[model samples]
Target chain A: MSGYNEYFDKIKLNEEQHQAILDAVKKEEALLSQAAENTKQKSSDTAKIRFMRRAGLIASCAALLALVIIFPLGKRQSMTPANDKIPEADTVMSSDIRSEGADASLSGEKEVRTDAALSPQENIAADPGSIPAPAEEPVASIITDAVIPNTAKSDHAFPEESDRSAAPANEPYECEFAHSIEKSGEETGEEGPVLVEASVSDGLLIFNGKSYRYLEETITDESAFDAGCLAVITVGGDALLDPALLDIRSGMFLYGKEPYDRLYIRLSEDRFLCFVPEDN
Target chain B: MKTAEEMVSAYENMLYRAALSHTGNCEDAQDMVQETFIRWLTKRPVFESDEHEKAWLLRVVINLCRNYVSKKGNRGNAELLDIYPAADPEEQSLIEDVMSLPAKYRDVIYLFYYEGFSTKEIAEILNTRESTVRSQLLRARNMLKGRLEAEL
Candidate 1:
C-alpha cells in the first residue's frame, strides 16, 4: 500500500464515533417512513371533501323546487286591494330578506328565500328550479373576462378611468351584492376603500370592474338552493379581492390552483385572494 | 421494511460519523442526522435497496449541512474549526494542519480517509464531476503530505 493508504488504514473510530453514525442513519429511516404515512392520510381526507361538495349540490336542487310553490301565493295575497295600505310590509320584508341573505352570504349559512314581489301570473309561468339555471350560462361567458388584454401600454388609461369613476362624492356608493344582505363587517371597521355592494348576475359576483376585500366574508357566499349567490372568496382571511378587475365573463372557473393564486384579485387594497388546497 | 428500532441500532452511528466529519461538531451533526431522519419518515419516497436508502440519507444530511453553512455565512458567522481530540502528541499538531485546510480540500480528504468513500463515489455523493473529484483529491493529498512532511 502507498504511504497515503497506510495513513488512511491507520485511522480508527472510537465507540462514540461509531454510535453517532448509527444514530443518524436510524433517524433518516424513521423520517422517510413517517412521510409515507402522511401522504396516505392526506389522500383519504381529499376524497371526503369531494363527497361533501356533491351532497351540497343535490340538496340545493331540491330546495329550489319548494320555493316555486310558496312565493307566488304569498305575493298574490299580500298585494290585495285591502292589503294595499301596508306598503311598509314590503319594505320591512325586503330589509328582512336582505339581513337574512347577508347572514347567509357572510358565513356558510344556507338561504332559501322566495321573493314575494313577483306577480302571481309571472310566478305561475316561472320555474323556480330554473331561476338559477339561467345563471349557469353566464358562468361560461365570464371565462373570456379572465383573459388579460395586452394593456401594457394602456394600463395608465384604464386605471385612470377606473379610479375617476370610483371617486367618492360624500359617501361611498352602496355596493349591490347579488345575493348579499349586509355590508362586509371589515368594511364597517376599516378606513380604506370598502366593498359596499357586490352584484350577482348569473352565478358571478360583478364588482363593477373594481377590487374589494372580503376580509370578513367566507368563500361561496350563499349556500342554499335558489338563494342569492354572493362573491366567493379564497385566501388569507385578511384580504379582499377586486371583483370587477377579474375578467370573469360567463363560464370562467372561480377557483383553481395557479389561476386563482396568480389572478391578482385583491378583495381589498391590502388583501389579495389566496388559493387554499381543498384537501386542507 | 425495517422496524424503527432495528433501523436506529443499525445506521445511527454511521450517519453520525458522516455528519461529524462533514460538520466538525458532535451537536450540529447529531441534530442534522435527526432532522434528516424525521424528514425522511415524513416525506417517504420509495427506495429500491438498502444502498440506495443509505445514499439518500447521506445526501439529505450533506445537503442539510450545506444549508446550515450557507445560512451561517449569510449571517456573517465564522466558519467551524477543528474540535476533535487528537489521537497522540504528534497527531495534535496534525489536527491544526488538517483543520486549517480550505473547506474544498478538507471535504474530499475527510470523505476519503475517514468515510472510506472512493473518489468516484465521493463525486457522486457531492454531485460533482468525477474528474473534479480526482483533481480535488490530488490537491488535498498533496497539501496534507506537504504539511505533515514539514511537521516531521
Candidate 2:
C-alpha cells in the first residue's frame, strides 16, 4: 500500500489546470444566486394570489347572506296593506246592497248581510241557527257565486225560518257554508262542464290520467248522510287536481259518496254526475 | 463555514487530483472539482472539523467523477497515459497502470494509499462496508504487483 501511495503521489495537476477550475467556480456561483432569487420572487407572487382568492370567496358569501335576511322582511311589509283592504271592501259592498230599493222585501237576505259583516267566529257564536242547511240552499246560486264570479247573485240568499226547521236537525250548518266560502277564495277561470275519465282503487281516485290519494274521509264524527254525502273527500296525491276539470273551482269538497257506493259530484239540486268505476 | 472562494482555494487541488484519478481527464477532473465547490456553496453543510470538511469534499468530487465517466462511457487508457508526461519512464508506467484499473479498485487504492485513510474511513467516503474496501484493496494490490513484475 505504501509503495502504491508513492506512485499516486507523483500524479498531480499542473498550474494551468488550477487556474481553469477557479475561473469556472466564479462563473457558476453568480448563476446559482440569480436562480435562487427568481425562485423566491415566484413563491411570493403565488402566496398573494392564494390570499386574494380566499378574500373574494368570503366577500361573495357575505353578500348572499345579506340578501337571504332582507328579502322575506321586505315581502311581509308589502303584503300588510293589501290584507287590511279586504274587510273594507266587504263593508262597502254590504252598504251598496242595502241602498237598493229592489232588495227591501228580502229581510232574510238583510240578516245574512249583517251576519256576513261580522267576523267568522262572531257570526258562528252569535246565532248558530241563522246559518242555512245545504239542501234548502240552492246549489246553483252557491256554485255560481263561488265557482263562476261573473254570474254571482247581487242579493246573497239565506234560508227562511220554515226551511231551516225543515232541514234535518243533525245536519252541520258550518261545514256546508265553510266549504262554499273556501271554494270562493280560489281564482277560478271560465266555468264549463268537463267529462273526465275517473276510477277509484286502493283508496286512490284516478281522474283525467292523474291519481289522487285519499288523504282522509272528511266526515269522521257524524253518520255519513247527516254530514250531507259520504265525506267531502280532499284531493291528495303526487300533484294537485286542476279544479277547472269539473267546474268545481276547488278540489277539496267536490267529491261525495252516495248509498250505492258510487262517487258523484253534485252539479245542482236533484242532479248528480256519478262516476261508475270501469270495473263495475 | 468557508466562503465559496475560500473553499475553492483550500480544497480544489485535493479534489481535482481525486477526480482526475477517477475520470482520467484533466478537463473533466476540473469540472468535477468546480461542481463540488458549487454544492458546498448551495448545501452549506455543517462540519465538526476541517478533517470532516475535507472528507465531505472528497466524497462529492469522487461521486461527480463517477457520474461523468458513466455518462460518457469508459475513458480510454491512451488518454490516461498522457496524464504523467513529466515523470521518468518507470514512474509514468506505474501511474498509467494505476489509472488503467477499474474505477472501484482505483477508488479504494487511491483513498487507502494516497489519501492515507483507514479501511473504515474509506468505507464512510465510498458508502460501503469496511470489509468490502479491504477486499478491493487486496485485489488492487495483487493486480498492480503482477503488472509491475511482468514489466520488470
Candidate 3:
C-alpha cells in the first residue's frame, strides 16, 4: 500500500471490529428510546400530581366553609343582612350554631335546637351581661316591638332601672393625631379617621403605613384631641386631628387653637356614624 | 420519501466510521452514529441521491463526534481512548499527530484522507467554497506529513 493508503487502511476496521461498532450503535439507540419513554412517564405523573394538589386546595376551602357553618359564637354580629336581629352579645359569633347534646329520646335520635327561630327578646334576656347600658335600650325596645309575643311586650324583661339608663347619651372623645408624613410635592393631607397603627413623635403623628412627616403649622385647623389616638368619624370615615380640623379637600383653611370649633365634618353624610377607637 | 430504517441501515457503518475517526472511541463513535441517524430521520432531508444521503450522515456524525471529543477534553482520559486502539503504526501516529494539530487542520485531514471524502465533498459538507476545501486539504496533508516525519 502507498504511504497515504497505508494510513487509511490502518484506520479501517476488521470484520469483527466493524460488527462491534454496529452492536454499540444498537445499544445506544435502545438507550435513547428508554430515556424518551422515561421522560414521557415522568411528565404525565407530574401533571397528575399537580391536578391532585389543586383539587385538594378546592376541597379544603369547601371544608372550611362547612366548619364555619357548624359552630357559632356571639361576638360582633355579621354585618350581612342574612339575620334580622342582632344577638344580644357584646361580641357577635359567626353564623353556624350547634346545640350541645340533649338526653336521647326513646327512638335514640339526637335532639338539636336551632337558634334561628329564637325571639329577639329571648336572645337579649339570655345574656344581660352582654348589653351595653343606655346605648342598646332603643335597639332593644325596637326588637321587643318587632319580635316579642304580644303578651311578652307587656311584660318588662329588662330591669326597669336598666330601661331608664339605656337611653342613648352623647359621648365626646378628644381627638389627637401624631402627624408624621414626609410632606413634599403638592402637599396632600388626609383627614378623617386617624390610623392607630402609627408612631407619634414630638407634636407629629407618623402615619403607620405611609411614610410622611408633616409640620404642626401645616395643620390648618385645631381641636380637642389626645395623643396616640385615632377618631373614626362615623360618616365618611374622616379620621383627623381634633385641634387642626382643616377640610383639606374643600380647600377651606381654618386657623386657631380650637380648630375643632369649626362645624364637625360629618362623614360624607351629616350624621355621626359612630366614634370608634382608632385601634378599631 | 427516505425512511428512517433505510437511512439507518444504509449509512450506519459510514456514520460509525466517521465518528470513530473523530472521537477515537467505540462507545462515543456509536453514540455519534445513533445521534446522527436520529437527526437525519427527524430532518427527513430530501437527498438528491444515495451519495448525498451518505455524505450528510457522515458530516453530522463527524460534527457530533468532534463536539463530544472536545467537551470530554482530548487529554488525560485514557479510559475512553483505550477501547478503540489505532489500527496500525501509521494510523496511530497519524491520529496522535492530528490530535495535537489545531482543530481546523485536523478536521480537513480526517475528512480528506481517513474518511475518503473528496475535496469537493468535504467542501459541500463543511459549507465552504471548493477552493477553500482544496487548500485546507493540502495544508492538512502537509501538516500531518511534517509531524509524522518529525516523530520518525
- Residue runs of model 1 more than 4 Å from their true location after superposition: A1-49, A59-280, B73-84
Model 2 TM-score (2 dp): 0.49
Best TM-score among the predictions, by candidate number: 2
Best-to-worst ranking by DockQ: 2, 1, 3
**Pairs that clash in candidate 2:** none
* lDDT of predicted model 2: 0.55
| Candidate 3 lDDT by residue in tens digits, B1-152 | 75455656666666665666556566676667767766764565888987887778767876786677778865421432355455667765655666566555656676777567888888888778889988877777788778777888
lDDT winner between candidates 1 and 3: 1
Under CAPRI classification, how is model 2 graded?
Answer: acceptable
lDDT of 2 by residue, B9-125 (tens): 788778877987788777777788888988887788999999899999989999988888889986665655665563567767787778789998998888877888999999999
What's model 2's lDDT at B24? Answer: 78
Query: Model 1's CAPRI class?
Result: incorrect
Query: Per-prediction DockQ, in order?
Result: 0.10, 0.32, 0.07
What's model 1's lDDT at B16?
Answer: 61
**Model 3 misplaced stretches (Cα beyond 4 Å):** A1-280, B1-5, B75-91
lDDT of 3 at A136: 24
lDDT of 1 by residue, A108-186 (tens): 5444343445432343245332221112223223323333323232222222334423422122222232322212223
Under the 3 Å rule for N, CA and C atoms, how many clashes does model 1 have? 65
Model 1 residue A204 CA deviation in Å: 49
